[model samples]
Target: MGSLIPCLDLNLIPDYSIAVTPKSEPKLEPLDEELYFSTPNPISNSDPNPDPNSDVIQEFSPVSDITGEESDVFSQYYRISQLFQSVFARKLPQHSDLTVVDPNSLAIVPQPEETGVSAAVLNYKKHSRSAEMIRVSTLAVEDARYFRNLVRTTRMLYDSLRIFSSLEDESGRTIGKRMRGDLRAASLMKSRGLWLNRDKRIIGSIPGIYVGDVFFFRMELCVIGLHGQPQAGIDYVSASQSSNGEPIATSIVVSGGYEDDEDAGDEIIYTGQGGQDRQLARQCVHQKLEGGNLALERSKYYGIEIRVIRGFKYERSITSKIYVYDGLYRIVDCWFDVGKSGFGVYKYRLVRMADQPEMGSAVLKFAGNLRTKPLAARPSGYLSLDISKGRETLPVLLFNDIDSDQEPLLFEYLPKPVFPPYAFQQLGNNFGCDCVSGCSSGCFCAQRNGGEFPYDRNGILLMGKPLILECGSFCCCPPTCQNRVTQKGVKHRLEVFRSRETGWGVRSLDLIPAGSFICEYTGVVLAREQVALFTMNGDSLVYPSRFPKKWVEWGDLSQVFSEFMRPAYPSIPPLNFAVDVSTMRNVACYFSHSSSPNVMVQYVLYDHLNILYPHLMLFAMENIPPLRELSLDYGVADDWGGKLAICN
Candidate 1:
């Protein structure tokens, strides 16, 4: 490749001015030994002395200031940022067992005999070409599934790099310059021909992405074909795609970058690209009807719809801004005008298309208001402010908006499962890792999880296994160990709301990222023999065997891992216990059943080392928008008559 250019930072020379170049097919060549083993550190722009020829881009602050209350609201996110930094600084474990690849051949690498984390990494590289071929030939019907897999795989790869960066001996010094994870990950995918929607351009919606989908980085938008330009606010198709041989606008990002940009819920006053002195935050020259400006004019004349993505300052993120796909919009009106800086600028009015989902930014704003002032935002439906009665860190709101003020059948809110006496007696000696700081690569707990940390630095599960062994009470590691994820109780603000169709259900007041731990299925544990008795007596009993085998599909790893290289987890004996949440339950009890569920049940063993009695933890299966109902597959027919049994 060439010297890497920082694309997402708008403070750099505008990336919009760079023409979109078609990616050439990758030719097989001998892998550069230095490139594979030692990635050069990106040139630093923070040097006191200047390199006149170096197009160095410094990191820019997206937001000027954050209020105290806002800081408090996003305190959890700040902790996550710190956690990521610590993980990055730690030395990754050496993996001598990894299979070495021949630099001269492009043939797929053979599966390694050792089935560990390092093996998985090699498998990912080996199968990249195969996965790219499948993605390129993907039919429209498979677009949604393919897109989801691509996004998940990209993030997983990026996270893996951050935690497992190449190191130089014991000093914890990384081999190369530390770069932004998103950029590095996206670049890797692009070089390997893994990016989708490359050969053709779509004028309207991308098939797999939804209206309210949330993206954390600008490169995500580029890789997913939502917005082709990494930093450019405008995305358009050139003259080749048009009948009149003129470019047409396809999408634009309204991120408050231009002073003239105005965002209304269903409408946006979008400022066309260019004619700005970004350093001075003002227009310096007249905006010409060329490039994006001309494209927008052509789109309006041709009655073409444009995609509108909105960006907001996200206090809970390291990047500081989140982009939401707000659906398609038409360029209804366009005009040249004298701007705030008294310079000519192009302005366009865009009206959102009809029958789309609620504006994503509106939902975020509403959730924020609800968090700050619950009484004012939702004045009516709340039944009890704190259903846990101060037991939980965050309040669990009980609401009834459908028909009656009737609360759920009275029950104790149990945060953790209560095991029967015999369940504990069955446990062999409990063990824990002895890392005083935090559980890392060499920790015993990580070893138990196939010689790699089960989670990434940010506490997101890296992959789904038959069982995840977390640090227990016996560990010398601190309570904040990345391994101890599910042990932490519900992190999101949840609500038990009455649904007109599904009875009582749960929804989140925050955006839940994919692989994020939601909560545990807490209840009174019963012996396996007692399950049938409880079911016969009309008690709500959850059978561990009844949960779907969706773990194999969690990270979409089938694309990379060959059949043999995939983790062949030891068969976990059938669970000897069942949880009865009918009388004593928590928020997990209200999760409704869905054929295509957003939440997945992960079997985790942390409090104890017993495999037969692993804890049932719920995690978000994909990026869930605020106020969206949380659901899981119950692994039963929809007509199943059991009432409470279906919800858990």
Candidate 2:
């Protein structure tokens, strides 16, 4: 095979400007062995399934007339063509394994498996294809416009269909190099387990994963050491965990927790005896510890596991085990360093993906953690629920999924939600133990609170972090179980107040402590497509460049301009759903925007998993004084980096 690519259609090259001669042979150099691809072309009849990649074209089929000077340009097109043809098309490596493949005979290309950090590698050999592609797009291409068109169109169309974009041309205007990089950086494809979008500003941390001190993570090196954790020392080792019993590191499989790590505190490290670690300050690392560079570096790949060393379950079978592979977490950062215990340690944080399956054993083992005591769980709502109902002066946060659009309370008519219909949803499963003993080990309902109620006597979240599992109707216990804190509706007094900057905002009527469980944002749950229909101005919501057309046509003003004069910010995704409070809502609908926000929305996953939407549970990030405006950082910033006006 001489040519590594099929003869692409002449008309199909959307960005092609001039003609190409069939005589233009590939001037591609033997850069390295890391490239391979396939495209269908003519094959012999004897072998029906010939590898399209097996044969290569020696001479090019002329797409259009080309100049003699353009021979070098074709080589670049050939390089990128390889990457464009390839897909993941393979299973993820198992148990931290890496593999090498042969590019030519399709045999393994030999390379040393044992490579060390800080060893300068032949990067040109490793990144040759990317370098060639970048060169062609940057230096070789005579027309910047042409490069922009082909690259952006290909990226957008390929992403939208979740397949190769065979189409040469798409409808909208093509983005330039700068815009493409920005959009790509901001973009996050959870299904792909990758984040490369560079220009997008991240305003918050992934919940439970980056809590407390280890707040700085962005796909780079990080450090984590389990030396002096509170439970044991740094790594949650139990006193019984020793060489004679279980290794201290192994004890983390059972006794380690997220809170313990946060409370363990920082272990500062310096370059010399003095503060010579300029690299630390330059990176603005918020945590003061370091050391675990290898674990952090290797974890950047998709499907790689940031094993928390907690007990989840052994793979392939469902049985209890100490070492929990806390799903496949991305390694945002890691490093090497010293500990606060006056010893060397590594400190880094692994952010849990927003949603994923737990280990099979972990799920089953959780069923045994509930206590026999009566759960204090009860219906969640305000004490004045009866008084607030149907009142025009203030909003009543009804949690029911009723479809009624009640009268306007502050700005316009908002639909009031009754509390989440958990009681009714629970009727389907008998996982709830008999209400008499509350939730017990025998009751699968106890898994909601790790086999115990999640709250103290005063109903505060026991550790300020919980995978809340409120007792459903299936529970044998009464509704007042302490495990039912989130279900026990709005305890904080809040009211809607008109704002000069934002349309309306919510303010606390009483003081609220840090980490307080605030009210959930309730409304008619609708898919992204459904939200687009009513939202006139679709400019406020943050979305990838590829999704702008789906939210609203930029060229179409009437479709985007709302009657209120502000651009509508409808959160859009391929299928992201929104909780529409336009018709009926609680005081949460009036929450304003804050760069340094006091509260943020967290999806509570317990019994029912609504794939279209997670229950948007709001939690206070810090203490709030009485009469202070309650707000959240919605993460939709404008070009100038200011929070959008519609966030309130």
Candidate 3:
């Protein structure tokens, strides 16, 4: 009766296919080294499996949105598409024991047997080692020493697994299963052991790890949600599950709380020495986000701040600046740029900041230790402390020796401490704008192009340099405004047009001279020490970074810039710096390739304006053309089609 009942909806049984699974057979021997990296001989496409064009089940009907908004349907399609991709794109056959009856079919099959412990461990360890080796070898660690260490460690673990397997009981089925699982877990732990290289000695594994049945990899990814924080999502894709599967990535919704707050917000409490409310302005973000710390995003985390009453005096003729982390620590001293080029110094000590008499005595003792000069200390300077007198005196000590020029200011130190700038200081406007003091008539701000040139103050250009309005009107936001200020070199080309009575004409152009000074790019200058404390990797460490582009380091100028600057602008001539060839790019420009020619492209030497203030005189090689609308090449063997392949 049940077989006959299906006659009404006979079409429901859609055509599908059963994919055959090969019987498992252990290899006769362990894999050879060559087989580890053997070339994949894929089954030729011409030799298709039986019913290769068919599927094992009816394709799942895509869920349609009855409510037909274009956006809603599109979104539904996207979600369904992703889910379908995840299922069908699996590496191993998605289902087993199924026959293909239809070409275009889909169905939900019972889950396959779990990838047992042995298979999982083997795949996971191989995948893990590959990723680690790739990253370790790519870093500037001199050749592949780091990668070698990883390979060595992996080999050692492989040996351990072999020994553990031999010791297990082959006859006790239950015990054998447990023993294999234990060995798999051990192998995983051994692989992860390399991550602790900074502390662990190469002596041996942590105790009990070899004996234990635990592997941290089994722990599932944990999602943590903090209150008042943005909703977040994290996806951990296993390396085996990805296309190519060579490297797996774990991306997360980086919470804002973990990052440093550039604008010294409520999380940062600035208490004065005497608890007096004096204004203390935090160093600008340009300084905070500089140096090796260039990758740090400042708007997310709370900062501990301790500042010298006058930090520059200790290190320079100017006030010495010391960053006391988090309003609390008298424990660590983070010294930053003292305005004197690259001289940065740091030290640590404990300070007591409390109200009791003991607290004062403790602070005084700490101050005494800090005041102690090194054997090489110059006789010209010393340290001083200012204490707020309450029930107990709170001591505020300087990091370096105070200078005579700054003595009066220290003597005039108020009982109250100056509060650094708060995050909310200007909710109306963004940070860094309060830089230029006062309001003036028609001050309309420097138009970056019109009225007064902003770089005029820095004096890099001798008042004759052309001004471009490219660096936005001063009224723009910081991000946009900074980008405008960084216009330099070929990037600053001006579009000149000729127009007649029709207000437009054939805009015939003229040639520019080689070594011509393009418009000056203007921006702020920061000391190298400041950058060291603030910036992260990937951000430039040059003292005079123009927003996104950092100035090349003097040491690296020849090696790094030579490669980057040569043929950097396809429309312009190549620059002569001694940089690595990896950085050069071939761009298209005017070229009349000739077996022999009158004008030959040659490397031209152009002097860069001092990077400090009023970034001016961005010079690029141009032509002293004897003809009209012609491009000249810097003729050199390297510049001709080899390294400079873009040449004509």
Candidate 4:
């Protein structure tokens, strides 16, 4: 089996008692202000006057020769062009299973004659495939990889469209004010037959979607077939589709939208939909035994398992609330009750099914408790309270529960990478943007990152890029700048705990959102030549190249954004250095290898301008549940013999 890092040897430095630090720090030369403020050049060093018909020029060329209202349209077009240029620059390998029935059926908006702008710039659209055009997927329900790919791709496309719509709004266009970004994206996907599990509805748990899985929007639930209803609280199988020729409840979302609904970890009192004046937040009329209400009664009689999703108000998120799939539940009982509005309402008592993973909401509450009082929660298995010893912003606990081993191999805990003198010498010149408050669109640093900020307002990575350029030390932007994400050490509370299957592994004490920065791989940076010498001397080195390039699988926007619009990423020279973390490393070193990982490694540049040796940062690939072991694909064979070798 192939190894993750070809020459990775974990048994480096037999004596772990010694603390190794960089002998000398490289002195960086002062930046020349004249050179720093100079107008930045385009990413590509191609001809200044390229052919007008060239796809690159045509798609990315600045819009000129426009006046008045047309300027807003053109500016919006340019913003979208830049967004595509920054985010979807890399062309990923297409999945063989993903087949469009009608590849030529493009969804192009009618261009207004006044603007005379390209239809592609007016509005990004999906390949408008009819419902009949969708072929039943041959992939099995248990095919986790395919399911992940489908969900991720759908999400990426949705986000890309949402960002495009936001760009239009930013450019002073008020086109989609009533329709939300998610709804708009969902509409596009639905029109193009890009959604999954739409042809069938399952009575039990949806395959590939596990209990504790989270979603930010109702449309996402519909796209993944977790629940078909977008706004309705209850989803049901119609009488025609049911086995007994009777409507049965399939799933329900408990969002506390109704005053009568009650949620207790394992049990939920779900209120039937309808008969409520949503505008007045009250029930004006009595609910009739029909639709979802009748389905619940039938489910109770048939003993059918109904999927329950719990929703919570999430102020930090743009969606305002988060939904967690709480697993299967059976409607044990149903009855009519007078709600607070003094109107009759139907209530169904749903009990969680047996022998399933812990409820996602319960786990979240437990995680919150653990975070508030760590000592009271665990009480045992803790080797050290704060592993960083006041180095990191959050505590990194060292835990041992499965074994009698007192502690992991002794090594100095470092939060960031320590570069040798030679590594600094490789960095020739450092330049920064002159933005006063923060670096936004059109800033030199933003231009270096392809004319847009790499991260969103919440500091979430907008999309995976070949190389992400962040504000450097010379930048005038404050530390709180949105561009500086990975630099902000460890956003989530993580702990290194002993695992029975994978030795010492890391798990988050807090829930990690998808695309949020996790932590950086901190250690002594070794140059290309020095890396070989250290390897020959039996020192373990981590090769950034060994990490899987699954960023391509994030999503496919071919139908949404035209192929020609996505130009090749600016050529970033291959990174040559390896981080020697065998002796002196952070929690990232203890992360176990998995064929299906929840985290991804992203190369980023911040402290230095050298793109050749960017810092290796890890970001959550999906919404990770609390206490779940964090894993990453090590770019090795699944059956690799050295899998256990990574366990330290």
Candidate 5:
């Protein structure tokens, strides 16, 4: 979920501290290079009498610093870092036999049958200087992933210990609650909840979250439910088990709340910051389901994403925005709560996955951090489209017809689309950028496409130079390299809507700023002759008998106008192929035509270099309000096609 998830309100200060497990904040010792490397605490081992040389590093010197590029035994250093982290954890895996598989070498290293704790520690400490090495190492992103996981795990593992220790010593409930309050007087960054509290935009009644929405409401790590309320279902805490002996995710209810108080006698009337009564409604939901949204017969939501506000042992801190994006879950069951309050309330119990990466505040200090940022996205929505009667769950779309139920004909007759170039080509022995400063100066591809990096920092398309282009697979750069902007997909909140005038149209569920990637109109690639033949035959099949044959004539004329754009964008491949979303489609096919459209199609040549046709991508040309229809110019669609009566 990208820009779509509504930001929390700002004005209303939420008291999330229901019962803070009291634990005193640890004092941060001054940074001392020598002290950090020396054994602050002896390594714990099963040996009742430890070896005198256990703490000694005979082979390596005490590590003073860890700059990723400087170390020769970087691999060995990384492995030991992981080992130290495991030892730091409360629960350790019992290793009687370990199978270290090296697939590339087709080799397997097996541990001895009598393997025990002493051997494990001995094996781990083989890299005599790893502890100090890790402490000093910058911990590049490649090596930082495990370290981040370790920090989060340790915090949670020791939380209970702190609580117990605090109870034994302090005799108070709110004992050491100031762990995050650093006391350095560092500015407490405004939280997402604070921002949302200030937002007064009330859609029907509630500000951002609603039922049927997927991954919309981001729950805080320790928070199990609405700030302090107990009416709805609480976010299940996976750390603990439930009545069913599973992770506890149950009792989340969002009820109408319907159109008006007259209908929703069960409406819970709440006061806003301005002291006006507000009602959270089910207005956004339709009893009549859409063909794409995958909702159950009774339940609305697909599932939700869980985020925990991870607290660290101290050092740097991560903002609430950088959440561990636990993947989406499925709604197991939902039923009418039938509360006495007369609200048409419903409670949905979600089934959390037994295994998934925990998104916590534990991020690498040096390697940036692991966070769930708004996806520079390609898919229109966060969750997958549901399987409906006319559509299969396997993504299907056909652009020519609105109810395009056919699979791409090309797939049946031809091989599936391959990566760019398809076959190897010799390096032209020409100048190519290091991708560091390459985009700024002399990369021929970048100069022709305007700046090397097409998108700005927030993944926004750089203005003035609007023709979207990116370095293809042939480019000697990693995928994460900056020059690939359009490759990153639309991060906006969008939905396909059915209208009276237009069968289906695309719109942003969230407000979209100009220069955002609205969507990419993708489909089967066809040759010019193939598309000509397709329309010639498709005209009769698609146009209903009830409509006059003049529609067919108009379709032909529209084809001509659409082709006039061909010569202008040589990159758009010859009118050789047009994207067909009718059979397998996304939100792009639903976009309607407008003379002054909010979005426009731009040609991009990346991903597939062999295909002469540049991918005609969609981007927002102007600001689009929430729930406003998005349209394309449709290439002078005075007649048909652009303003097709049946847009898939």
Candidate 6:
């Protein structure tokens, strides 16, 4: 094929733009094998029964036009036309009488393959066709705009319809299987012992046999892992339903030999309803077979197992149970206490439990390390249970920190959860077991004193930084200090206190003063309960769980306001810092006595040195001294003998 790329100004093109040209036709060696073309244009026929993708176009020749000097532009267009003809010839069979062929026959050139081609090839053809169409539209400047818009609209509509059809099919499938109680759906088609989608088929392995065939999978559900005793089986659920609203299985068979059909025992009836009941039924069936009572002829089985693993006294104990349903209202599993001490090992054999023993009770396994290789012995004392009712149950797993005996609560694995796992919806206290410290961090059973933060007095929690107190730690010591200097400067108003007795007064401080760093206060952030009872604008707020309320809420409000204030800052934005002079220790702790005071707290300046802008005189408290303690009396009387009106 000849090179026919339009001469685009090098300076006008972006880096991603590449010249469109055909590679040079390399000289064929004597030993080179000749290339072959199809005898007929497979893409020309629209046979419905042909290979699903036989008619799909593979490569498209773009019509490159040069819009420049008449001769040069026509020459470029001619070369592009010649190149298109060459590619067409390369992909089509030779004709004995070329002169007899029809001119319109160029439309059907590249023959299709018996099977579909790669997506890459199809995409390339689409882009090439799009480029050709665009070039054709550009012939007339006015026609370019209209044609571009029309093409864009058509492509958009096609994409929208494709997505809409896909969604519609999915909705139909979901609705059709809604009546089934099983949590999983079996694809009408199956492959590789795994589930497949009913609508879209999976593309076969790349560059392998049957590469273009559509593959199907069914939603298969089996017990993935057993947590507790071998006797206590795990719960399984499916969403598929029968026309009469009966639950159906959603999985395919994997493995397991039934020595005798009778050995599997009578079919366990799941009287309960909902997704949970179905799961519980599956668990029950598993436990019955795992336990010797309902013998399993085959030793090995391929299926997901769910069980309740109970941990106490720093060690984990697993229990096995059989899920049984008593109508829709009650669905639970029966626990079989088969004593075994294999941690992390999946056990299949099970034994019956002595009673409906509560799971959280202290129990220890001492025969061998649970992590060691599994034993074939008929281990006794594995706990199991029947699903009594409801889709959930308070976790029977107990966690006790060795540092502090306080028990940590964990929720059991509910196959048919009321809500999808980790949804963070609803206020239910039953959060799944602490997956953070469990699987990810690796369970350190012997760590910590409840694994929580501690707090200090004064309602201040220091976190991520250090704090220092100049004065010695004050724990209700009598105040005693002298020679305290409290001075307010004209330019930078400052208050200096000289204490001799206690710390901040005039008695103990000496004249020759050299500053020295005080001991640092090192502590972590306080517990949420430390300041549970605080007021924001006099509206009481409480700590909810481990997070703070009100104060943090106000901080958030300030931050949002600051965002809007950015454009108007220094002109309309209000100042951020507000010093509270009500308290003597606070810089803004100024006091006054007046029913109708003239002064009020207002934005002063961005800098700390500047006082309140447009300074409003203070109505100072009565008997105020130069060095005496300053206190703000909120409920003081004015000279007119009226009570001060406090806003909040």
Top-TM-score candidate index: 4
Q: What is the lDDT of residue 98 in candidate 3?
A: 27
Give a tens-digit lDDT track for model 5, residues 1-648.
112233222122334443322211111111211211222222322122222112221111111222233132322212222222222121122222333243222222335563334332222232211100000223444334343333222222222122222222222211112111111001010111111211221111121221211111122211211211111112222211111112222122222222221211112221000111123322222111111011121122313332212112322212211212222334455554333334333333444445543222111221121111222322233232321222321232222223443322322211122223432354453434455434532455555443234454455443322234576565666666556766655555444544556666665544454556666665565554555787875641121111111111110111112221111212332333454544554556567775445565656666544335555566665434444567775554342214554353
Cα error, residue 472 of model 4, in Å, equals 0.5
Colliding pairs, model 4: none
Candidate 2 per-residue lDDT over residues 1-648, each given as its tens digit: 111222121112232333321110111111111111221222212232221111111111112211122223222122222322222112111112223242221222113553432111111111111100000112222243333333222222223222111110121111111112111211112113222211121111211221111111111101112111111111211112111211111111222221112311111111111111222322212232111122133233222333233322222211122222233334455455544434443444455555554442343233222111112221332233322454334333322122232223234433233333431353356555565855443345544434334343455332222134566444567767655656566766555444444555565543454445778766666556655875765533322122112111111112111221211211222336555554455566656654335565544444453323445567655435444567665555432113334334
Which tens-of-lDDT digit does each residue in 302-341 have in candidate 3?
A: 1211111100111210112111111122223223332212
Sort every candidate by lDDT, greatest first: 4, 1, 5, 2, 3, 6
| Of 1 and 5, the candidate ranking higher by lDDT | 1
Q: Considering summed lDDT, which 10 consecutive residues are worst modelled in model 3?
A: 220-229
Whole-model lDDT for model 3 versus the true structure?
0.21
Clashes of each: 1, 80, 61, 0, 44, 97
lDDT of each: 0.62, 0.31, 0.21, 0.63, 0.32, 0.19
Tens-digit lDDT track of model 6 for 414-466: 21212112222234322222332122111111011011110111111111011
Which candidate, 2 or 3, has the higher TM-score? 2
lDDT of 6 at 352: 19
lDDT of 1 at 201: 58
Order of candidate numbers by TM-score, starting with the best: 4, 1, 5, 2, 3, 6
| 1 versus 2: better lDDT goes to | 1
TM-score of 4: 0.76
Best by lDDT: 4
Over the full model, what C-alpha lDDT does candidate 5 score relative to the true structure?
0.32
